[model samples]
Target: MATDDEDKVLLAVCDVIKGSTLLKAGRSGKPHFRQFKLSNDLSRLMWESAKKMDAAVLISQITEIKTGQVTPVFLKNPIPQCEAVSFSLLYSDRSLDIVCKDKKEFDTWTTALKALIVDKYDNKEAVSAKLVEMRGSIVSEDRLEVQLGTIKTKVLLKDNSCDLYLWGGGDRGRLGHKDDKPRFLPNVVESLLGQNVTMIACGGSHTIALNSKGQVFSWGAGPQGCLGHGNLRDRYSPLMIDGPLRDVNVVHVACYENHSAVISEDGNLYTWGKAGPFLGYMDDSVTKQTKPRLVDALYGTRIVQVACGRSHTLVIDEEGRVYSFGINKFGELGQGHDKAITKPTMVPNLVSICKVSCGRHHSAAIDEDGVLFMWGWGARGQLGQGEPKSLFSPTPVNGFNDQPLEDVSCGYGHTAAITANGVAYCWGDNASSQCGVPSSVYGELSSPRGIVLPSGIRPTQINCGANFTVLVTSIGQLFTWGCNMSGQLGNGEAKKTFSQPMPVESLSEKRVKMVACGEDHIGCLVGHGWVPDEEVKSCMACKKSFTAIRRRHHCRQCGGIFCGSCSTKRYPLLDKGHADPVRVCDKCYVSLSSSSNIK
Candidate 1:
């Protein structure tokens, strides 16, 4: 009797091959073998006659078959100089001899015939039921959750789970765990262990979380009333922000520098914290809004998306019209003026917009035609317009006109976009390697250039932090480049930079669904099957033993284990995802510095 595993293999092979093959025409008076192809449903096999040609055989019409038949061969030496397995396929009207390359091939054909016989008369319904069960099981394993923080720390939150994990910097209650102690490894937020948190966002020194019920929670530095609790008080633990927003079903939230914004399901937008002219209010009477307040100017317009810059805000309505209100020191508002706009004013000449992104001092947008528009600070070429001059109004990025972008993102001083074909393009500051290019080529890219990756690696999503970039591929693989000062790349290293995209090996086993970045930290959502690595006891490069004094360190560039002595060098690495100088091992230092030709 065949084992269950063998039976499964046979069933799979039969389902894919289905016994379709080339057969010589005997009674049809043709010298050529006719090719038969299976229909998509596998119910029938169609073939063309050798002369007039066009015939088909239905699997349901196949009768009993005999194997190893040598008498009454259809053609003499069907395959020249090769041994072939012959069998008789009995149909309702006639019998035909089928020749195969070998016994293995003959067995495959026989197995498919047997399966079709059984399926046609005995187990068709049973097999269909089993397939449905298998499909359900596969779908159950697909749910995933991803979270990201800044260079100072990291966070991880899984879907359908209530626990929020935090690591790295814990200053000013940014970790949301009621303490200021940094966590070198992931630690659960005991307070939110069963709260069923759904989303998380991080800023310079603050954290915000949204639960399944749309309730908003915030913590950390509130110097500018970023907490949205109606006061400039810092909370060491997660505190629910309730009041006007309590009854609203908030769907999305974003944070920048000392400001925060939330959008409700009904298309309403609320903002708080560091309320200068940037929060859509021009009144000098209010410089800070400790509580979430509705933008009166956008009272009737339904906002579909919102993004925040350091001191500015951008909103898109249901009609694809863009509105900007905030500081315009570098023309970030794209309003043809350098002065601040106290109201949500329409960004002129921008229509059919589909997506928008904001950097610390610049903004980017993509339209229905896949055209990219950029404005604001361009000193480092973040605008991608072939120059470092700032734009006071929305200007089309002509370089990408031929590329047809699908998505675009902006970093503090760089910009990245993905074309419809999944190719990634980046431009702007290479000072810290943020542009994924060498500074020796050009300190800043005045125009967009392609970012090369290994074959078969196609980016599905891209995001930029203060100085680093993160990408997630179609197969759920995560890659990071630019600066790595705070281990934001999640590569387990602390190298100064990576001039190219490198896989985050720690997440090799886990299916990463989402990733977010901050100035010094990263957060990711992954499937439930992830396994943590054991602690390293030796340097990955020199094999030096690690002691209490000789602590274990990680190379930011390669994400390898290293000792303090082996990882003591620091370099201004923008490509490894850092905005400043970061410590790296000697190997990475030499490679990164030599590539850029910086002594």
Candidate 2:
């Protein structure tokens, strides 16, 4: 319960002198200056209270006094009158005159007024708390980790305590906790409560986490050695991987559909799981990497970054050289041939690369010169070449030759980039509004188009999920658009899609330092003081009590708390990038089913 007085606290103050006046046009069409006297309190002045002359207003509410002028009056006597500075403050339907003894006083008063306005109105306790929370959240310099499986999950790491939190579907132990128990709110992974987990990556049915000591741990589905435990065995809890990577200090990890890759502190790369002919293997003789194996071909190359597509792997070396392996069905290998490579091979015609990104079947890279090169599948215009033609080799993206790009990201069928000038651009598939285009024109965008954002908003980093895009601005503001069926946009809504970028209001109180998007989930690392949603004791849809056997569930479509009975149905939420069946509440199921029929 807040009172109006609490909300209308003193926001600003100014020092002033007598005999100075502010002039503005009156209703009679005549310009006039009102005289006033200064009180003992520098913040206060003596004026007609009946005219609401003492009403306090925020500095932002003050309109610029462009037409009004301030005048100082001097006495023509034997002794010259002291000089005075005059300024004007305009409010809605009213104007104010402020006079200071000298120029120094005027400047001091203006600064004080502006500073107090921000301190009193913008610096609320709630905002401060959120900032504190964001600072403690786990995040890379500009990348926030978010994942979407049947459920949405995020990881938060503190100084010495790493906690894995999950909500939504909990099937197959994907949540890394009790099996079959879905969570509606964030629930900590008890096994990793005390460990210093620094990084986390997710596959279709598995999860992998890395700690500060360079130790790797994994859980969930293990078929095809996706869990990297030296055997295709699933673990309900976190298990430290102690195979060939035990002696090495792992710094980064990436997980695809059925395989994983890790980078060590020494810039060495290790890959394992689901090895097949399409993944650069000469034959299908070996289909599973039960243990981590070194990439022999990259022995002399020091890799700095790694990205994984649905079935292929891309790595960048210290010298900005690109190396790729795996399937080339859609030219994802960028090897000038549609044939798959069985080993790590240098990508021809690409060098000085600073960043690399992989999509479901396409690949993109940014060179030192800020040029963006893309290749592979382009049926949806992902190549940004003004046509839907697949390429076996890297091709420079058109239309950005003069504007250097700072960063770029690739989604399932689209591409996004941020220019050095802080403009955001997107191209390719917009079927789900992923390209930030209107839904009525939900087709391919052959060339990059600047994403219209609110005035003054400048994007610094950008990332794309399967069918959605998230970006952060230099001011720490986050904007999200595209599929919102799973609340991945973090607007706390279940709308099917957003055709334009919208601010994430839920994080307005805190500063968003990093953001990561997965197939259907989004994670954010904010500054301190964020309070997570409370765990509901009863189902949100049916309002049923929870018991020992009656487990809780979450609607992937709406992010609502529910009971198993209320969320028993499953559907392919295309807008959320779930092409396979995923859990949905009865309400969403009914709405989606009806909409499908209408379409």
TM-score for candidate 2, residues paired by index? 0.58
* lDDT: worst 10-residue window of model 2: 73-82
Look at candidate 2 and tell me the lDDT of residue 298.
77
TM-score of each: 0.60, 0.58
Q: Model-by-model lDDT, in order?
A: 0.70, 0.66
Instruction: List candidate 1 segments past 4 Å from native.
Output: 1-169, 177-198, 528-599
How many clashes show up per model?
Answer: 45, 19
* Predicted candidate 2 versus true structure: per-residue lDDT over 478-529, tens digit per residue: 8889977656676665568898998876456556655555566554444432
- lDDT per residue as tens, model 1, 295-329: 87888798988888898999999999999999899
